[model samples]
Target: MAPTNNHRTRCGDTRFPRNVILLLVTIFVFLMAAISIAWLVMHPHDPGFAVTSLSVTNFSLSDSQVRGRYEVGLTITNPNKIITQVVLHRQGSLLLYDSELYSKAAVQTTVNLEKLTNKSVKVDFEVKDQHQKVVPPILGRDLNKGVVNFNVVLKVTVRFEAGIWPSKDELLDVTCKDLDLEFHPKTKGTGNLLGIGKNCSTKNAAGRT
Candidate 1:
């Protein structure tokens, strides 16, 4: 009887741990289901961005030094029906030439867009004097061809309000690629966007679009 009692006690101890682990796993699964349900009901969608225009003025590159003024037009749209409003905080824009970062600028103004509404904003970037960055010889060669391809990338913090619930800030990336600027034959310093409009791709910080 003593040996039997000891064996019974060890069996009880092992069962206790198993029971606890099962309870924990059940609770975890329940919480995950609840969160997933809530997320589906909310059905949040990311905003859309498009590059309406890109123009360059006073553009020059001499001795590897570059100076230019870029005016970028962006159209931002909120596509969420449940979300009442979306706010985009201050953001930074990067100008890239041949995948190399040519210049960077900050958008000081915060943008607000209502649901199913779109707004166009102009962002100006000036690279001159101390703000100018050195360019590679390849860039100069490309500029002489009367057309240059560039890319613009934007990093923005976005927040949306759905009814009374205000979401946490999320980092988003907007990439505009293959923007061709055609310079005037007489004035190489002035240029305009080649195509009608370029649509940019957006993704969240987690790499989800």
Candidate 2:
């Protein structure tokens, strides 16, 4: 027989320490979870939108169609501290109720919003003979009330900005349901916007029709 060795394995001692490996794996899992939670807590948020002003001109309604010119003023605010939001130039569609009206005729200037800042954006669109003949009877009632409420659907493409890395673009769809805007036929132009009602809400509509 060979001489007995003091600290040597017998022919088949290939097993590892199971307890140490288990501890290492548990630690790694907890570490990764903690990091994920932290990242979520620090994620940036969407910017803010508000209708600042509105002016309506050449307003008319007939048996054929409703023709009008509307000047809309908006304030885009970025409340984030480390992110930037870009509103693409003349890339949004505005709709009134169920009618697919107000097609964009020109290219609007791009707006670059810095962190913790606000920018004013204005858009003018015309309502021509393309409008639907069937008008909601309530339109006249609301107009007479000095408040013409319009449910506007706005869709725009935007991009997020961070440091160094290229940002991907996304679509933001805002549904201004029953946006109660003050209108005065007695006045020469569009009157003051009472305010976008509290019922208005926004949603991200990327990859949608």
Candidate 3:
């Protein structure tokens, strides 16, 4: 009877630990499932960007340096159906020639976008002689041909607001590629962007599109 009692006690102790472990694992699984469901329900889509127009004035290339005044027009759209508003903050634009940054401008404005709505904004860059960047040989050659192809990149911090919830700030990169600026023959120093409704690609900081 004593041996049987001892054996029963050991069995009880082992069973207790196993039961506790099983309960913990079950709880963990349920918690993870709940978090996943919440994420799916609140997922927000990124906004879209399009280059509506680009204007260049006072353009000149001396030696290897380039100077110009640029105005970039953009159409920003919010495509999310559930998000109440999208706020874009601290925006900046970069002008690139063959992947090299030539000029940059700060957009000191906040953009508020409602759901399924679009807004138009313009970014201005004044590249004076003092702020001009030395152009690459390839860029100089393109300028001689009266048409120059450049890339416009927009960097912005974005936040999405739902009913009462606001998401964390996200950094986004918007790229408009192959923007051809054809210099006017008569004006000599002025040019306009060729192509209409050129769509820009947006990507997150993690390089996800």
lDDT of each: 0.73, 0.61, 0.73
State in Å the error of residue 25, model 1. 20
Instruction: State every prediction's TM-score relative to the real structure.
Output: 0.70, 0.65, 0.71
- 1-209: candidate 1 lDDT, tens digit per residue: 35798899999999999999999999999977876676578776777889899998998776646677888888888787644333343444445464344445645546777778888888777665444456667777878888888787776767766654435457788888889999987885998999888889988878898
Residue 111 lDDT (model 2): 74
Q: In candidate 2, residue 121 scores what lDDT?
A: 78
Q: Candidate 2's residue-wise lDDT over 125-191, tens digit each?
A: 7666574567666666666777765555556656666664445466676555555667766673465
**Over 4 Å off in model 2, which ranges?**
1-42, 88-100, 129-131, 195-200, 206-209
CA lDDT, candidate 3, residue 41: 90
Pairs of colliding residues, candidate 3: none
**Candidate 1: which pairs clash?**
none
Angstrom error of the Cα, residue 180, model 1: value is 0.5
- Total backbone collisions, model 2: 1
Ten contiguous residues with the weakest lDDT in model 1 = 84-93
Q: Which stretches of candidate 3 lie over 4 Å from their true place?
A: 1-39, 83-96, 102-106, 128-134
